[model samples]
Target: MLSEVYPFQETAEAARRVQLNDHLGELGVLCLAPSPGLGVTDATLRSRIGEDRITSLMAA
Candidate 1:
């Protein structure tokens, strides 16, 4: 999903650096839910799209 909308054409680590930070970047529904009976853990979080980006995309 994040692959198409944002074109990371200038880096060697394009796949690793690409993010859904554009308005249409993550063009699908996504939900975050906790796993049942799973209490543990640490996670690395990344920001997909910022509020400004969404607003800009919508206005376009």
Candidate 2:
């Protein structure tokens, strides 16, 4: 189930890590965007369109 919502802090931490690595690129920093192996279907995303927050986030 996708009931477990990930908090914003986790996303912030990931961004912070990426920025840190990018800033220290002289140390041979490398980044790879591999598939997450899990994703919400288009139907599921469409279903969330009515939700104001979800819609706003999607728009952003």
Q: Which structure among the candidates has the greatest TM-score?
A: 2
Where model 1 places Cα greater than 4 Å from the true spot, the runs are 1-47, 56-60
Best lDDT goes to which candidate? 2
**lDDT by residue for model 1 (1-60), tens:** 332322233233333444634344433211222222222222322134433333212111
Candidate 2 per-residue lDDT over residues 1-60, each given as its tens digit? 211222343555545656776433222111221223233446776577644434211100
Candidate 1, clashing residue pairs? none
How high is each candidate's TM-score?
0.14, 0.26
Q: Candidate 2's C-alpha lDDT?
A: 0.36
Question: lDDT (0-100) at residue 4 of candidate 2?
Answer: 22
